[model samples]
Target: MTERQALVVRGGWEGHHPVEATDEFVPHLKEHGYTIRIEDSPAVYADGAYMETVDLIVQCVTMSTIERDELAGLIAAVENGTGLAGWHGGIADSYRSSSDYLHLIGGQFACHPGKAPAERKGEQADNFVPYRVEMLPAAAEHPITQGIGDFDLVTEQYWVLADDYVDVLATTTQAVREWDPWHRPVTSPAIWTRQWGRGRVFVCTPGHDMDVVRDRNVTTIIERGMLWASR
Candidate 1:
């Protein structure tokens, strides 16, 4: 079989460590017969020449903006049978102003509420807490979730605004932070798949920290997800 072509568009917020995060998965994808292309900017999304032939795009950009034509190019690429797959803020939280981009992704990061630190300094820090990722029984037979049982992970548990159109495979609840009274027991989609024209969209929101992205459970699911989403 010909090697599958994959483009990893990395760069945005340094906090997410896009370079390190994307690097960790490079070898895994290579083992799965993928020839990877790494781009440090979202500008790669605008390259119709490159996007036209890529089998998969694993975006790792967070809280970044895309040019109007670039965003349109990405949309067109996916709609024209180029698969789009990503995790965390890279694919989901990116491009806040682009509804068309969000429409393609099927979800967006609203918040990541964690338990507040016990000790008080002059200022408070982002709560980094633990949560469990639960895979729905219906996804048991799905390619991405097969043999992937529920597991507990410590990271920034994201509360996302998700669309019903995607095939939800896994989820995490919002009961970690007692501070947020309104968000208790609210289940959010952690892993899901959507269709954009002839292409596929795969999303997972577990990799806030590099450690979380390196977790075998997360990496395994992502490996499978990339193959599943590839054209």
Candidate 2:
């Protein structure tokens, strides 16, 4: 078998704790026989030669500005068959200036309407909230979630606006509650998979913090998902 490699691009908005979180996840990939390379800046991604030698790219960057060439190289690498995978705002809300980047990934982070209560300040809304994630039939059979069951989490239940081309792996139904004024019933995808050229992409929206990702179910599911998404 050919050797496998993984490049983990971290370091963006410190609020998301990219360094800490990616540090915790690196061991899991290392144990899976992947040679992991960690970068604290986006410069590494701009280097075309560096980006081309990898089998997979695991991004943990959130709300940061990336240069035009750097962003283009990352997208081209993925479109040319380098697997890409990430979770939460890191991948979904990253590079707001780049429309092509969002197009390549198949989803964008919309506002978290459920947490927008007038009484609670900005701090409260971004804090952890309890919710349940429902596994879709298709995801239940997929390798990433095969043994995973419906689980409760206290993390941010992301309400993303997904593209139609994505195959939703799981969903979290955001229910209207007294604390939240919006009473519209809707289902938001928690996990999804999409194909870009010969590459595969898997995204999970449950990892708001390192503590949330430490959950056995979440860790296992993400580890499996990384392996499944890697080329």
Candidate 3:
């Protein structure tokens, strides 16, 4: 069989360590018969011809901006059967300026609520909380999540604003602590898949750093998601 193509688009916030994070997955892609092409910017999305030849896109960009045409090309590529997959803010929180991009991914990072004032310093790490990622019953049989039981992690638990278009597989719940403003607990999609035209889009929200991404459960889910979403 001809080797499949995978485009790794990585950049944006240094905190996410896009390069190191994406590099860890390169060997996996290669072992699965993919010829990898790595780009440091979302600009590669604008290459319509190259994007068309790609079977999978693994994006690690976080909180970055995308040009109108670049976003358009990405949407077109996925809509035309190219797989799009990412974890954490890489895909879920990327390209905040484009509503169309948000529509394509079907989820956005609202915030990761931190510890109470007295218990925390002013650091991003304050947002790292212990949370359980529960696999939803509806997705228990889904290929990407099958055989994986719910697991716990102490990481940046994201609060996402997602749409109904995504088929949610797993979720994390944020409690209604006294310091928090919300009256009730909030549950966000921890793992989800979106079917866009001929393509598949997958997102997992636990990968805040290398350690989190390396978690056994997270690693397995992401690996499965990449293949499951690929054309």
**Highest TM-score, which number?**
3
lDDT of 3 at 225: 96
The C-alpha local distance difference test score for the whole of candidate 1 amounts to: 0.86
Residue 144, model 2: Cα distance from true site in angstroms: 0.6
For candidate 3, the C-alpha RMSD (Å) to the true structure equals: 0.8
lDDT of 3 at 2: 70
Better of 1 and 2 by lDDT: 1
TM-score against truth, every candidate = 0.93, 0.91, 0.98
Q: Which regions in candidate 2 have their CA more than 4 angstroms from the true location? A: 114-126, 178-183
lDDT of 2 by residue, 1-231 (tens): 456899999878886788887888788888778899988877787888877888889888998888888888887788778888888888888888888888887888775554545545667345566888899889768998997889999867777887799989888887777776577866888888889888898888888777777888888877887888888
The alpha-carbon lDDT assigned to residue 85 of candidate 2 equals 86
Clashing pairs in 1: none
**What's the C-alpha lDDT at position 144 in model 2?**
89
Q: Model 3: per-residue lDDT, tens digit, 97-213? A: 888999999999999998887889888778888999999997778889999999999989999999999999999999999888899999999999999999999999999999999
lDDT of 1 by residue, 55-145 (tens): 8899999987899889988899889988888899888899899898899899999988756645434321344667899999877899888
Please identify model 1 stretches exceeding 4 Å from their true place. 117-125, 176-178
Model 3 steric clash pairs: none
Per-structure clash totals for the candidates: 0, 0, 0
